[model samples]
Target chain A: MYIVVAYDVSEDHVRNKVAETLAAYGLQRIQRSVFAGRLPPALVKELAEKLRRVTRGANADVIIIRVDKRALDTAVRIGPALPREGNVHLH
Target chain B: MYIVVAYDVSEDHVRNKVAETLAAYGLQRIQRSVFAGRLPPALVKELAEKLRRVTRGANADVIIIRVDKRALDTAVRIGPALPREGNVHLH
Candidate 1:
């Protein structure tokens, strides 16, 4: 499953925590506050629950969208050119 | 066709222009930098083209994802509650 997590957290610390958690889940930071990656269905739920825990208080709005990999591949990506495929560089 | 548009633009004026363009396209600003709504595939392409034109010679990165309505309906939405369905307020 392909997941996109976008958050609007007012508090800076909470926002940083949310970003860090998403990164820990192996999701790539596609935008400033948006992270996208491929994860198992079970993992998606787990990630959501974790996000819920982190955003218990404070003004935060987090949206987790599940999109198909094929759809994402054909996404109309504008601006700076990024790798069409997943980013991998470990030489 | 549910579409999600997320952008990271450094310039304040350019960002505002991008946001205004997206709003004009009838996409709801889900997060600070993310807008999403249902749109026709052709409209999506049109929106992309318009975005491309607006983002010329700027440090901007925009991503447009096409996802199913059902997937968006079942999205794991956390923090501040929003309408499960579309926002309708014309009283």
Candidate 2:
């Protein structure tokens, strides 16, 4: 399973900490505020709880999205398709 | 259908233009390089082709992900769950 985590954080310190926490979970930063990678559902649940604590009281909104590869393989690319980071791309 | 569009473009001009094009298609920016919203499958194919054209060159890689709301409703939030734009929530 692929998890795409996106957040809207008001405090810089909390935001950075959230990013680090996501990275610690082995999620790759696909965008500035979006981190994504492959992880099991159980792990995702665990990390979501951790992130919730790390982001507590920062006036932040974080959403974790789960995408099956069937959807990703159908990914329509508009430019030179570079190899994506994990099971994100069909090898 | 919910479509999540993510891109990695090396050029600022192309990136901005691509973002504008996505916005024109009713896709909202959930993150810096990520956009998501409600769009039908046929429209997704159409917009994907357009994005491919707009993002041509500039050493960019763009991906479009489709997610069902059954999955979004399962979204676990750690902070204040602000009403997400479009068909991204259980409401």
Candidate 3:
């Protein structure tokens, strides 16, 4: 499934660690606190466990919202935002 | 359709304005720079126009990804994140 991971952590260092973990999993950073990409359900489950370990005893929360790939390809772009995949070709 | 809006803007005020706009449209902030909610397609289009206008002279980008409600309900929650709705339970 395609997922959008968004984190809100109280500490900067912890936040960076969380971001790094997401990046390590090959998720694209779409916003300061958000990342998105496609992953198999098993990997997502693994990520959830990894995230739990990273945020242990910290005031942090991360949500991995499932996104439909079709929806992502036809993303409703606003402003000058460009899709990472240039060939998506949606209006 | 349910949508998840994520933004990256250059200026603080502009970013706040963008967030305010999203909030006014009843979107829930899931992270500092991300919001998610259900909106009619017409409202989503209207939001795209408003975002464009707000970011006219700014170096900013916003992407709204459509989400399936079933997908959302079965969100792959990670860390200590809790769903906003306490009743819509899932594991």
Candidate 3 DockQ score? 0.67
TM-score of chain B of 1: 0.85
Better of 2 and 3 by DockQ: 3
Off by over 4 Å in 1: A81-91, B81-91
- State the lDDT of candidate 1 residue by residue for B1-91, as single tens digits: 8888888899899999999999998998877898888888899879988998999888888888887877766777887756553221111
- lDDT per residue for candidate 1 within A1-91, as digits (tens), equals 8888888899999999999999998988877888888899998888888988998887988888887877766777777655553221111
Question: Top model by lDDT, which number?
Answer: 1
On residues B1-91, what C-alpha lDDT tens digit does candidate 3 reach at each position? 8887888899898999999999999988866787888889999989988988998888887888888877767676554556462111322
Pull out the clashing pairs in model 2. Answer: A78-B52
TM-score of each: 0.86, 0.71, 0.83
Q: Pick the candidate with the highest TM-score.
A: 1
Residue clash pairs of candidate 1: none
Please report how far candidate 1 places residue B72 from its true position, in Å. Answer: 1.1
Interface RMSD of 3: 2.1
Model 2, B1-91: lDDT tens digits are 8877777788899999889988998988765677778898899878877877887667776767787766666766556645642225421
Q: True contacts preserved, each candidate?
A: 0.90, 0.75, 0.89
